[model samples]
Target chain A: MKKLLKYDYQYLKRTSKFIIFPVVIIILAVLSPLTARYLNEILAFSLGDQAGMFNFPDPVVFDSYVEYLSNLSDIYLYVIIFIGVGTFINDKTKGLYPLILSKPINRVKYLLSKYMTLSSLIFVSLMVGMLVFSFYTYYIFGEVDLLNVFLLSLLYFIYVELILAIAMFSAMYFKSYITAVMITFAGYILVSLINVFSFEFLKYMPGMISSNIIQVISNSASTPDVIYNVVVTLVITGLLVVLSITKFKKYDLN
Target chain B: MDAIKTVNLSKSYNNTLVLKQLNLNVKKGEVYGFIGKNGAGKTTTINLILSLILKDSGQVFINEEEIKFSDLAFKKLIGYVPDVPVFPSYMCAKDYLRFTLDIFDLGDSMVNQKTEEILEFVSLPNSTKKISSYSRGMKQRLAIAQALIHDPEIIIMDEPTSALDPIGRNDVMNIIYKLRGSKTIFYSTHILDDVERVCDRIGLLDDGNLIVQDTVDNIQKNFFSNKFYIETKNEPKFVLKKIAKINQVQNAVKENHGIVCYLEENTDENTLLKKLMEMDENIVEFRRVKTSLEDVFIRLTNEKTT
Candidate 1:
């Protein structure tokens, strides 16, 4: 276990992508509220007189936050996928796998270290981004609900971890970074397709939970929707993570 | 007791036998040279001993403990250097050493002192650059440094000197030779001269079997031709026939410039020289040539096939 931690720390320290990707996510997070504030102006300019054609009730700070979460969900998920794929590919391609295997570390501990490092990084970065978005939204809109933002960020954290699990699985299953990315994207597509089947159980698909979390934060649904999304997200995340760990254990490092 | 032993070790990849019923025993503190051709299962044998690859059948005992792949305690006793040593490209030499030390759970004081000592031993003490910038030889030296850092009882190197130039090879050889009495070094290489220079014993692998295993001197002595070269001004054919007639001479074959007489066992060297001189007083040169490790390897492998 100690060896695994040491190797994990070493890998995290050495890879620039690990540091850079999170910085990019944090930058996006910091800018999310600003982008939300300008959404009204940009929409007005682009639509000109047509902008009034689609009017609704007054948009609140929660609406700007909903926009932030949606944008982050769609784009930063891809960033998470990119960084996760890199973590595994770099080790395999750089010949570090053989060296690590030659050490006294076991395969289980090795894979666990990678999963934990990536998941922790993703969760921490997402939380920091959510905090920044929350602070900016409150500053610009003069009113913000801390409890709602915290709940939204927690739900998004689950979603990011689910994506991390999938990304890690893809990385372990395939040797090429491009292939792993394609597979992860394909998995996202599959989850989206499953949502279209209209089965109530399919609402619990890991990807849908993220969208539902955003919906809950926007107050677009009742208390039942938020509860269902949390439960489904936890269950799916648990299953996928367990599956990844099992597969990683038997994987031949060669 | 043997420091390392393998019994009937066999391994196959994709239905092709790479190592077949091989056996080896390396005594403690002995420099055992595993000599084989490029594809002759030297690496496979080493991998089996290191538990990097699962053996199809066999038991490997290290320090009298049966090695289990799941239990890495046995690994703490070994230091391994692969044909190509790999490290994280972003790590400076010092950090890399620290990382290794951390995994092995050594103390900070010991790690710092040992890292400096080993880096200087490999002549890389001042190299603060990331490992990716190191040359092949430098990487090899660093590999050796890391392998020795933990103070393992055995060091197993696979083709350690293959990528090295003469100077690098000599440097590595010198380091290995300096560890002569303290550590047991098991290295596999096709470089016969390096084996001759450092290895106390050698095992020659040919066609998936250990065709020869013995001390360097014993191998040379056992397979070496006991023929004495005799140069004489007189017609060598007459001397050959005369030598052939003697009971002490097994066979006398004529050469272009001289005659070579194979002596029987227990034949007195002084008596043979006296007889040869009496037969032809114009003898210019008479000497026995010793067989080299290469000659023994070739003879044993050739004998195995035919």
Candidate 2:
């Protein structure tokens, strides 16, 4: 495990992915809330008093949190997916796998190292972006609840883990990063299409978890609702990991 | 005990057989050269030995211990360098070596010491530049350093020098020569001249099986010929006629830049030389034609395919 860590840490140190992830997320983090707080000014600046064309609600602190979560779900999710897809595909294409597989490491240990490294980097990047946003959120709007923010961050972490697993699984399956990204997003679109039906099944889709999490943050959804979302996401993630490992073990590598 | 052995190993891809009941043996501390053409399953066999890919059947043993995919003990005994070794390209030479050394769990003291010795041994330049900036020859040298960092007993290399320029090829060959008795190397290549220069024994793989494995001398002797090669400034038609009339000479013909004379059974060199002197031809060079591994390789492979 330590050796795997050394290998991955060297990769993380040099990769532009780590740098890009945090910068993009930080921008989104600050922009979401700022956009929420100053929607009136932004509209008036661009449209004059004619911006009264739309029925805009008064800006509130809750509006900042809600808009931030919405931006995270809408835009930041695909960034995570694209980064996740490149993890294994690079190994295959670069002819590095034969050298690594030739070493004394087992398949499970190797795959685990890759998984942990990619996931942890994404996790750290998300936390750093959120921390920066928290400071700005407080500066702009008196004081936001730390406890509520912590719960929301935890929920977001769980959701990231799920999508990352999906992206990685697709990467392994297709053996191409671009194809993996396309398939992962395609899977997203397919599930979202299924989600549009008027049924009790809406809560089961992976995207619905974000809404449930935000509702939990806003004190509208029960803790049990959050648990249901967590349980389902974790279950799906567990299955994706198992599938990846099994397929990776059988991979020809050469 | 043999350093490496494979028994009836077989492999196929998508139902097309690539390796068929192949067997090989290399005694401890011997340089075993694996020679085969492209599409003759050289890389496939190497991959199976390292357990990079599963074999369809049969077993592999290193230093008498059988190999298993889950067991890393055998892996600890082996280091591999591919035809075109790929590095992180973002790391300097020292950083990349440090990563490989960490995998062996060596103490910091040993790591630092081996890093210096191995780098110096391969003769790579000490530099802070990233591997991405290194040329192909430089990368191959670093590949050797990484493979030897663990001090493994067996080193498997696939065409280590085939892609290098003459100077780089010489550098790689010199490194292999220096490691001769200390390490057992299973070198795979199609370059016969390299095998002639470095290998202690050779294996010829043709159509999914090992057609031959023996000492370099033995393979040459098995395919021995009585043909003699002569290169002279003398006229070719005159030399061919003068050589054809000798009682012991079977056939003589003009070759590119030389002449070939086949001696009759039990013919000796002195009797032929006397006739050559009597003919008074200007003999610039003369020697019994040596049967090269390349000849044996072509004959054996052609025979199998036909």
**Which structure among the candidates has the greatest TM-score?**
2
Best by lDDT: 2
| Model 1 stretches astray by more than 4 angstroms | A47-59, A220-243, A251-253, B227-230, B234-282
Number of the top-ranking candidate, with DockQ as the measure = 2
lDDT, candidate 2, B133-227, per-residue tens: 98888888999998999999988999998889999999999999998999999999988999999999999888788989999999887664667
Interface RMSD of 2: 1.4
Q: What C-alpha lDDT do the candidate models reach, one value each?
A: 0.79, 0.82
lDDT of 1 at B273: 84
Interface RMSD of 1: 2.2
The true-versus-predicted C-alpha distance at residue B66 of model 1, in Å, is 1.3
Weakest 10 consecutive residues, lDDT, candidate 2 chain B? B221-230
- Across residues B1-306, which tens digit of lDDT does each residue of candidate 1 receive? 788899999998889988999889999999999999889999889888888777889889998778865668888888888988898888878777777777677747777778888899888855678889998888888888888888899999999999899998888888889988899999999999999999999999997898889999888777655668887777878777787877788767898778877676567578788887776558787888676777667767776879
Evaluate model 2: give its lDDT. 0.82
